[model samples]
Target: MKSWLWLLVGLWPAFASGNDEAAELLKRVRAQHSADVVVSRYEIEIVRTEWQRTVIMAVTEDQRGGRYQGMVIAPRRLADTLYLKRDGRLWMVIPRLRRKVGISPAMLSEPWMGSDLSNQDILQGDAVIDDYQHRVIARDGDLVTIESTPLPGRPALWRRLRQQVRRDAVPVRVDYFDQDDVLQRRIEFSEVGEVGERRLPMVWRIVPMPEKGEYTLLKVSGVEFDPTLPDDAFNALEQATAGTATSP
Candidate 1:
């Protein structure tokens, strides 16, 4: 623990220069991802060398309060399984077992719903940028590569991230690395087009490193962003359905 703190302190001075430019670029990227309320259906395909599985989910996340809720919509066995994150706590409620359990620190780092993606990856999208200090590392034509390090004491799963973003500040890909700077995973964004007012990635594919034929693909089946959610939307389950908005 002490060593990690020392490492973060030692690394702080190097990222000071160009932090302004990095900050501005991240702001635009955040704007592209930001929404007051996000209601969407996601089709997640988990692929492995031995087998493959797919899960469909309905998600309603209140970005303003940092609360997220999701329920499985497919695969009879795991159907109706629910997940919730509120007030910095993660909970997984299994209707099959009639159990609700808080996620432990170890479990928090594990695969989310048996997918290659981590729990933090699904529950805290804000932490990708908000918990990291970023700096421009490289540039090529319309593509800019930026390296980001986790802020000290932050609950960031990855120690560092290298994100390739477009000139318009839309993120194209992100590589996640551990504390030792070993590449762990890569997330690529494509099928880019306008979603509401933002140029969003309709398909996201995450690949694990070290020649493992394991990955997860999340495609937005239907989505509407920043809709006027009902007041009881996040408070009550029965009437908590997302507000009206059409996806084109």
Candidate 2:
């Protein structure tokens, strides 16, 4: 019993260090990608067995990387459609119909705009630190690999995330796994360049599991870390959705 206790005590520091390292690394990565408020415009190319199309969008998000309001910029059919993510929930505003619809569970889990990225994926980047227990599992020189498990009661559906990032916090790749530990999809980051003061991925490629030729690509065209946006900036969209827009 004494020997076992000593063995357990000796292992705790290594375990604790792994956790601490993971937390710090993730925080650094978040700091680089997140800011007070970020406005970005991107193009998405989705190629699947049944369809292929491009979508252009503009998004404004808060510092947490969780809350966002996005508008579809092109493709006349879906044009002007607005989506809002706040408080871990989703809502869609239809300008032509003049109504707002709640989105959760079913809608959140499905592919977004027919792309491999789900609504959850697009909105929950920060949840890695905010709602997960992660630890450094391995390290190879400047490349460190970590595994994150969803914290209890968190809204994320992914069972685990295996992420490989550089020492400087720029992510190289992330593999998402399902409850059975089966690979669901993987996102690869490449074409790194300066986005303001941060070195960020200019192109993000996501391929679903069972490894087929199907893939989705997101190209970040512009990114601005602006903290100047007023808190009430999104109110117009909200009020417009409710058919209660007030003239200023």
lDDT of 2 by residue, 1-248 (tens): 10101111111112223388877777666566655677878888999888889998887776444456788887888887887766655677776876677765666677778888776555454333455677889999999998877667865567888888889877788888888999988888899888767877778888999779899898888877764777686774556445432221
TM-scores of all candidate predictions against the true structure: 0.83, 0.82
> After best superposition, candidate 1 residue 186: deviation in angstroms?
0.5
Alpha-carbon RMSD, candidate 1: 8.7
List CA RMSD, all candidates: 8.7, 9.7
- Once superposed on the true structure, which residue ranges of model 1 sit more than 4 Å away at CA? 1-18, 152-156, 230-232, 235-248
lDDT for model 2: 0.68
Worst 10 residues of 1 by lDDT: 1-10
Query: For all candidates, what are the clash counts?
Result: 0, 0
